[model samples]
Target: MGVTLFHHVGGILVVFSLFQIFFTPHCDAGNILVYPLDGSHWINMKILLEELHTRGHNITIIRASSSWYIPEKSPLYTSITVEMGKDVKDFFDEFIQEQLKVQREGLSLIAFFKLTKKFMSFLHVGHTLWCDTAARIFENPKLLKSLMDSQYNLVLTDPGIGPGVVIAKYLKLPLVLNVRWITSGEGHFVLAPSPLSYIPVIPGPGLTDKMNFIQRIRNIFSYSIILFQQNFVLAPIYNAMCDKYIEGGCDIVSLLQDADIWLFRSDFVFEFPRPTMPNVVYIGGFQCKPAQPLPANLEEFVKSAGEHGVIIMTLGTLVNALPEEIVEEIAHVFAEMPQKVIWKHRGKRPSTLGNNTLIVDWMPQKDLLGHPQIKVFVAHGGTNGVQEAICYGVPVLGIPLFFDQYDNLLRLQERGAAKIIQLHEVSGHTFQRGIKDVLHNDSYRHNMQRLSHLHKDQPVPPMDQATFWVEYVMRHKGAPHLRTEAYRMPWYSYYCLDVLFFLMTVVTMLLFSVFAIFRCLFCKKTKTKCKQN
Candidate 1:
């Protein structure tokens, strides 16, 4: 009996030891490699990473050698540079080759070849690369091999496509897709604009803007042909090269499909009609940290405006090339306004300036938004700027340029938080009216404040949600269960409702035929009985 009891005690000890070994926290800290393309992208990424570091997550940023713009000093995060093989010269060379091929062949193959060549032109053979810099880390057999051998649990990526998604998919690692802007998915519930919303107008917006019924019909066909060329021909050509070089066997949409979860930097207040994907989460207005104090000069500038306050104008990063006529019109609008204007003019300043108008090459956007005296934001409706305005509960007068700016402005307009003025149609009258409407209207402010409350009253802040999801991926050893099985189904199977309807029609027809046959047989029997009588 003593020997048996001793054996039982030994067995329990063995079981406990095995459990400890299997469930022990091997990854106390996770290694997060970020790949943000440029300045704006880096700043957005920095906000999220800073929050994660604060919460005890290990973070690393890998960027291109030329991308030297640092928005913030992050001592906790380490930065590495991946060298590029070729520079701008190689890009031009590839462009020329592709153009020449297209001229010669007039076919889709040339377009695809040129895209691949252009991608290669930018990178140094084996040392440097394009697409997302994160791919380099994965392709670095040494780094990836070590991580695979070790116990790092998760890899968080951004823009949801390109190198970042490819690395996560190839490693069979769990990933969170940080969709900062609009992706190919037309119906994502993020603050980002849909690409379909920006389809260019033919004969431009000038003539087509006021087209009659016949003209509208003709324009639709023309637009369809252009769209067909762009989507079927041009886009596919570009995507094929992206698949070959950047993604290593996968395409952009396929990468998005493979992600464990999607984190959107937007709120439902804007009302983007998105499909109900179980893994997608809307966490907009994430950059709601307290603002840093404004500079003394900037503070003075606002105070000098007195009761009227200021109207801040900026045409975001990409569309800095404002036509001289538009600049003149903007100058005229400011001249007539009751409020002082602070314009972020990236190019040459206009010769005529009103006493109330202040033109600066660049302004501290967030700091300016936080100011109590600043009443209106005259913006290009970029997702970042739009969210910042909402976070601060400030009204916006949007000048939509390209891409998702139109949709972004429309969403804001629908919510009564802002108004939109198309870039092509901007004039002194329209500009002034838009400014007055947004600044004077009490409703815009009320709506903005309501949204601000909703944005702030989350179970966790946006950054915290980002951190929780990141760590959750690490803890679960790649959240395989969250991945959608949509890819496994064929295109035909996915549109299965159509297939079901087709089958139902066939079954109904067969049943009707059988009923008719039985009725005919009964009638023949009745006729034969009548003949016998």
Candidate 2:
């Protein structure tokens, strides 16, 4: 009876301790806010925020006034402006000035080294500092001060913009890094587009032939340099500044060491060397939300395409500036096709027009895909567009231009949900054949539908996962336990080659000693026998 009583007491204490550790001080769920630097990001943020709001969590969104590439006239502009507060612009201006000061100083080596070491330690942490040109403009000390004072549970930031990550660290807030593309070592999983979608590969006669070997080499080297700057240099420096300036004394990785959860939008189908973090959650197909209602005229226009159906064409926001010659080739291909084409041209239309082809400067993409008459989508394979197509259960013909587009299309191809055509090889025949194959092929549609169902059938949508994790951090007073011990291990030690060599040497010595002893014993025995004889 005494022993049993003691055991019961111990059990109660253990339970109480666990509660004190995880639920102490009672986390304020209302103090959660999301920062998506630009308007395009609002789409995904909106889905997650709406779900969270419905669940009775207070959420605030900081919206950027404009993006570098996307103009104010774009549909994305209006979407952001609708719910945007004034905080984003104010924050961005301050962020830019601070960044420029650091850059002018050429980044302090001491700070850089210190931050890099910290990053190396917790390399497995899902937190990443994104450094893109546009993001630099959005960092604001005053906004950070407000958030810090508010005691917000956590800050979720997009990768490619260093300022957000830096500010989160500065404010000593827990952060979740959102990787939108296949960027450096930051992404737990990278979303890449198809190789055929690249500008160099997009089908065109004599495209590669025009460039000499030296020019091609120069281009490849130039791309590598740009990647290096973004990944190795800028990312680390930005992180250091956040640590030194924002957190007062703590570095970026130390700030990140408090965070372990990452919400990735990439599937294995897109990125190679799939990154693993202690708490990374893959949520690639999350963008596959239900299609929005179509405009009356747009719905009618798609319905007019009939049994053969229509093909949708879009080059995405970044690379819509295609040369006239390539546009002409695309135009010619559409003219030859028996299937009607709905082309989303960002710029002026080509002179070559066909009765079957309807060229518009822009079209409501999700609505068009939802239309019954739409059969296939030809796209630049941007992450957002790909997810939308998958959600709508539409097959794609990926024409990747650059960056993660190759990786994104590769994912689609691996899933048998899309076909990839090289941009340089884009000819009338190739375009026609590729379109026909996707339109006529039963397998493409079947694979897309199957994946779409799997994507949609998740117990909670990606937005839910995103929201839950965010809330979980709040509820737990920050999920610090998820942070990895990678920071403790040096780069060389993480690889374990040093330990491996040490073990190998010890084993080799032991074997050699044994062999020598055996040889010595045998020799002694032989000498004894000879002497005895």
Candidate 3:
């Protein structure tokens, strides 16, 4: 009786300790100003905001007047609406449609160039609108005064858009970028050492880190496209904005590289091994959580699958549905499969609809991924979805449409955790075969499970790491120590090309001097021989 009582007391103590460790919030309650990029980026930003709110931080969001996802009133953050930005959401919808049209033309050099032009053209329009919006905010005196008076501890923002970065600079606040992408390219290219020999640029012609000579050359060529997009397409607009509003003026790339911390949305688990910076906190799957109990009807539907389990397919938020013909192929494929299919489809109901398939307008993606019954995830290869798939140990069948989707899936495919079927390759035969290959292949499940284990094995949970770093910036003002001074150097100085030139000059002079001495000696000896003769 005494031993049993002692064990019970110990159990209670352990339970209390666990509760304290997980549930307790840090004491600092900071005033944070957030300028978020809307659409899918807004989804992850909201997750980070919720965590900050839970920890007693007061959040203020700078949203455009035309933002669709971010509401004016929310318990999590007080919204500051900036007027005159376009209702920018529909632009992406159009861009993706055009990209799909181009992709369907299939693989050729001309087609590739055509698609790239379309992408660059799309970026030009997006950046032009953002520039106009930033100009409006800069022109507003009252808005500037209000932001200054609020006295934020730091500016936490999505650097996918430039206004937040400019705003942070204007306020002289310590900046923390919740970034996977900056205005120019992937965050790492600016933040860390990226050797093109190894680290393949995402969305470039190269897909994996291991590149041959030809692939490396292709990588360099593709990298130039990003540089062109940044310097020519985006720079003039941002530079003009900076000159007008900012005191002395600053360039967009400099302002971004000057950020105190980068909460990068990738880790080695999801990405190939590459060089990184101290301040880059990788909270790759931070938004993922343990699965909640399914709603009763959904639970019943899932249970009805018995031993076959289930397959969940979503092409992410941007795409409403695939092209009608492709959708019919996928729908017919699902009909033939033995497993239950819960597809997030809102397009015209396919005539090939199966009793085994459940079509919904939306889904709790994270929860469904986490569920033990989930067999394989058919995805559009978006960053959020890919990371979630990694977190949940679900193998993926990727149907890449456009943007970074193919390259994103390539990372998983290289690891043997996923398979990719191009937009043009989708057919009843291909879709069915790909699903079966991923579903039946034990290696796919085992490899994905390995990644899941590795991702979860971090000492601090990704979300906690993200929240800690945000508060750390507030406490320390800014982490200048972690930031490298390499960004301050000019390109020649940065790569030590100037130093190389100086060394080469010195070596050449020494060699010439030595040759002159030898020549003089030889001439004197010849003179002596002539005199002797």
Whichever of 1 and 2 has more lDDT, that candidate is 1
- Which parts of model 1 have CA positions greater than 4 angstroms off? 1-27, 68-76, 84-151, 180-251, 273-275, 497-502, 505-509, 512-516, 519-533
Q: TM-scores of the models, in the given order? A: 0.73, 0.68, 0.95
Off by over 4 Å in 2: 1-29, 37-42, 53-144, 180-186, 189-232, 239-243, 246-258, 267-278, 511-533
TM-score of predicted model 1? 0.73
Sorted on TM-score, highest at the top, how do the candidates line up?
A: 3, 1, 2
| lDDT agreement with native, every candidate | 0.65, 0.61, 0.89
Q: What shift in Å separates residue 189 of candidate 1 from its native position after superposition?
A: 8.8
Cα lDDT of candidate 2 equals 0.61
Best by TM-score: 3
lDDT by residue (tens digit), candidate 1, 86-114: 44334434454444344334437556455
Q: Could you give the candidate ranking by lDDT, starting with the highest? A: 3, 1, 2
Total backbone collisions, model 1: 4
Q: What are the RMSDs of all candidates, in order? A: 11.7, 13.4, 2.3
What is the clash count of model 3? 0
